[model samples]
Target: MSRQHLASALILLAISVALLGALQLALVLPGSDVPAVLALFTIAACVYAAAGIFAWWRRPTNAMGMLITLGGFALLIAGLGNATVAPLEIVGAVFSTAIFAVIVHLLLAFPSGRLDSPSAAATVIGGYVVALPLQLPFVFASADSREFAVASTTQRIAGAAIMISAAAILTNRLVRAQPRTRRILLPLYSYGVIAVLAVPATSLVFTTLGVRGGVAMPVIQLIVLTGVPLAFTAGVLSGSFARTGEIIQLSEWLGASDSRRGPLTAALAHTLGDSSVQLAFRLDKSDSYVDEHGTPVKLHSDTRHRGQVAITTNEREIAVIGYDTQLTARDEDVRRAGQVVAIAIDRTRLANELIAAQRDVVASRARLVDAADQERFRIAQNLHDGIQVQLVLLALEAQQLANASDTPRNVSTRATELRKRIDAAAGDLRRLVHDVVPLALLQRGLVAAVEDLVDRMPIPTDLVTEHENPALTSTVENTAYFVIAEALANTVKHSGATSASVRIDSNPERVFLEVKDNGRGGAVAGKRGLGGLADRVDALGGHFSIDSVPANGTRLIVELPCG
Candidate 1:
């Protein structure tokens, strides 16, 4: 035990001895031989004190322990009334009529430890007002005096009224409580309420029934009054068992929930019975926190009446769960509740991270693809406007010189030969510009481009189409063309093939393409042409595959999303 617990134990031990002495004195000095009633009071005080200490250690945030402990001490003090010393007797007389009033206060506060409603607060205040102040008026008076009789009778009548009022308030509160809350409180009501109300009623009702001054009253009072402390202890144990079940159920619920059911934060709060529960994830490589949407959240460590549990995985602080202390009662319970959902929280955080990384890769690929396309456009324009135009002018000038009437025969022949060479060079340059940009694919799309392409191939090829695509994004169209071009190039260079075939299936959402050739193929992916092609296709969220066997023909399949 810590210093705090040791000191508390010592103080309670001293109080127990004192109350034991008071019990002996009250039993011996009494006018009546009602040892059972006196003994029950002393035992009830010690029992209530033990229950209070247990609660205090378990739920330091709750006030119920302090109140129960106060009731126990008051019972001990009131028993001092039986002492022969005048000061001790006066002290006891002042408190003897008020013991029932303290019981009313303790019961009204119950498991939550705080009086929530106005009626509960008023009843406790009124009980003290009537039970304590009325006794003071007759404290110094003679036993036979009119004032003593009036004050004593008035206090009992008022005390009885407050007790009844308190009982009604408790009944209404219990009735209004929700189903889950009612289950937690029902034990206290079933046992403690009966015990608390019967404490005073036995002295009043049992007398008429001819049992109050007999052997039965003492036994009846002892049993009923003892139930008060026992009921609370039962409530605590029952709550713990119920909470364990809830924690288990919480894991099951989270494992099954999806978008329609809501997020984990809401589920955790509901499971723990504390609505003010908060969950936030820690940023990677930083001591900061963020929500699922990546919104930065401040974890207020200094906030009052709230406690936090840091959830860790792989020696990293992945998330934190903060809960209301007054509402939750125990930090260990919150930590246990967090343990139940640690895996779920970590999964969510990792998923968010992967999604973010994939998004960045996609964006970078798009930039690269767009930059390469723009550079191709620039080169194609330069070949057409500058080099091709200059070559055409040279061919025209050479033709004019060769056709001139004053030109020599040798000069004419040489100029004609030079003109033919210029025309041929310009033709080669035009073909190079076409390869760079593939204007037909941009203007006429995949079908027309492939038709023109296979017609120029050195080997015989077939083209098959299912749905001529309506339209597609430039990125998707570009990647599709590249897969076909690169696959055909690989077939030409590596495969000893005589024929090739191209197949296309297109829809609004996606386009599928297949290129197969009858060749002695032993092809593999991640090679020269296919490696770069695969990366380009993946950047656009597409799939690329190459199938080849030594005897079987090679086939390249590409699927590109349209939108």
Candidate 2:
């Protein structure tokens, strides 16, 4: 509780304690009749005071508790009407029935402690005006005067109308309430309505019993009125227990979930009954928190739209949950909610962190793959422009030497053989460069690259393309190119395939490739090339598979998405 609420509670506590002792003075006062009246009155007033204090202390942000407190104190002030002293009797008479006005206000406000509509507010104001200001004239005049009697009748009728309005307000609230709220508010408001209407109910009971004044009415009224506060106290207890139950259910629900941010966040929202609540995790590698989707989120007071409650366990901040600030006014209660669900929050946080870490690792692998591709391209460029030119020049020099008029036949034969060897070497180097990094795959697209590859293969290879996107992502292009190349290489090297078919298709989401070879196959994924290819595919949030049986053809499938 805040210091202000604490102070208010302390003052109320002192007054409640004092009222217990004041009951003895009421016993000896004039018009006390018997000790039973003081006992019942004091007990009923104490119930109100105690229930009000409990409500106020539990929810200091609400005014219902203090309102009930006022009603209880007002009831005590009204008891002074039993005194014979003129000053005391006048003071008591001023507030005697005024307790009903305060209760009317309390009932109109119901559990929220604020009149939701103008009509309810006006009704409460009217009740207070009729109970105190209008009744003042009657209290100051002679008890048997015609004017006082008319004022008394008017006050009762006004009180009755105000009571009916408060009851209608409650009924409207109950009808419009959501299931969760209505379930708790039903029994709570029922007791309050009964306590309000019971004053007349007890008078009717007296009329039926044919008794004018006795011990029976006071005792029955006390019992009936006492249930109001006790009902409030019971509602408070049930609400507390309900919160506890929700917290327990939170843990159990999180245990069965995938432990991702969305499910975990939704579980907390359901527990708190606040759909706008969001969970952001404090990742070890990040300076700021990220939401369930691993997107960076700024925890600020921008727009003042939500309140953030930090959940820390073992002195380390796990996460911060943002909720509707107006609904959850108590920061302390929000803190307690975080504490209760700390384990679930931390579990989802770790899961998100692990996912982020895995993504980073995949990105690192992709970077390395790109680096390797660049290095191979550089090597191919060097060989094509530098060594290949040098080999051509040497071959030209050998041709010139062989064709010389004075050249020996043996030397010319050797020169001819040297030219042939150089030409063959040059051809091999070109093929090697082409395999290292194909120009079609880099500059054109996957379809063109596969076509080039199919044309170069010694065995007959069929190529199919569907919805091929020339603007495919570089990551998808590189990974898809290499994976298909590896699978084909494996098929040729091990499967003894006669012919192969390659089908490449594309959509907005991803590129799909399938390579199938009609040959005796016995390819294993873990052997060498497929293992690394599998990791590469998975890292990019794609799929990869290789199928090879002893008598069946080998088939390789790969899917790659840029995002």
Candidate 3:
């Protein structure tokens, strides 16, 4: 049990024992009927005190909650004793008053009000110190009428003063704290009011029956009988208090929510009360967040902008932005959904950043590749312009020298070797230029350029197209031509294919190209040369797929977006 609760239980146990003993002694010892009535009041008091103690044992965090319950029990016992057949005499009343004093001390012992604030602590302790001593006058009241009046007034003042001040302390405690406790403790307030009134009602009913003593005893018995089972039931279900606490939290968040504008704002504007909620996060660290009032403040300087549900994550504060259109305080399931909004927002931000970065990197790399291709084309042009022309001129000069000279075998042999060298160097230069950039592709466009490639191949090849397209941008033509060229090269080098067909087709949305070879088809896109070509097509935001079976010929299909 918690310290506060344990103290309450101890106080209740003492009171129960003293009251039960006084009832037996007062009844058996032949005292006046008033003593017996007071004893009955003591029994009623014990019953209610026991109920409060049991509730405290079940939920210890609610010190004020238990104290409120205990106070109600004390009143039930005292009132019922006064109205019952077994009323307490002077001695029994004194014992009961001492017991009541202990209960008061237990209430004061609670670290309520502002435990951290010395002034709050002093005010709570001072109230108890002033009120506790007044129990003495009520216990020691003489039977004489004037002395009795003084005692009654003192008792009334003491009871009123302690109860009122404790209530004030508890109210302050709740207000300064967060809102969760209020929600959790709401049911307690309801049950307490009902239970407190039950005893007085019971006393009234018994009083109408013309009982010898005051109506206090039987009334208290009824309260105990009813309240014990109820307290036990509440204890059994007290785990729900945690959930109730969360409901209070949700209400607070709703009151403070601000989603005046965003991409979601327009769609959500009319969607605000009966649709599935979708939450998104923005890295929104403006000077201040806008509120319903349209005014702004430095968000860093104001706690209100800290969001309805703010938490520090990785040492950075983030707010959960809620977005469910149907979300409300009355929804029970939402109460347990802890910090989900914050998590959702963080995930969205991370996903968006990743997507943007991927796009940027792909674009950058494509630009670099284009620049490198242009540089190679320039170098190839230079070789074809400068070195190949010069070599051809030299070959012509050597042939002329052979024709003019009479040095028989030597001149003829020199001319033959010169012609061979020139031919070989020219062939090498032409292949180098083609590898750098297909000049036919640059000049003629995709269909004619690919047809030129097929005509040049040693093996028989068919160029097929449903609809011929005009010259595309240099980049698209280059990428498409090379993909077909590489597939054919692979067929020639390794596929041992007898025949190959290249197909080209296009419409408004995209351009489609396919190459199929009647080879021993085991061409894997990654394992074969298709991998590099596939990467090129993908860089253009297109699709590239290779379908090949072990014995079946391979088909390569590619699509490029038409803009």
Please give me the total number of clashing residue pairs in predicted model 1. 0
The clash numbers for all candidates, in the given order, read 0, 0, 20
Q: Tens digit of lDDT per residue, candidate 3, span 27-68?
A: 443544555444445455555555555544433333433553
- Looking at candidate 1, what is the lDDT of residue 546? 82
User: In model 3, what is the error at residue 241, expressed in angstroms?
Assistant: 24
lDDT of each prediction vs. the true structure? 0.75, 0.75, 0.55
Q: Using Cα atoms with residue i matched to residue i, what is each candidate's TM-score against the true structure?
A: 0.47, 0.56, 0.42
Q: Model 2, range 241-276, lDDT digits (tens) per residue? A: 334434545655655645443466776776565667
The candidates, ranked best first by lDDT, are 2, 1, 3
Off by over 4 Å in 2: 1-252, 255-262, 271-275, 301-303, 405-410, 457-460, 467-476, 506-509, 531-543, 561-563
Residues 278-359 of candidate 1: C-alpha lDDT, one tens digit per residue = 8888767777676766556887677788888888877777889888876676777777777787888888777656665676
Q: Candidate 1: which pairs clash?
A: none
Task: Point out where model 1 deviates above 4 Å.
Answer: 1-246, 250-339, 458-460, 466-473, 506-511, 525-527, 538-541, 561-563
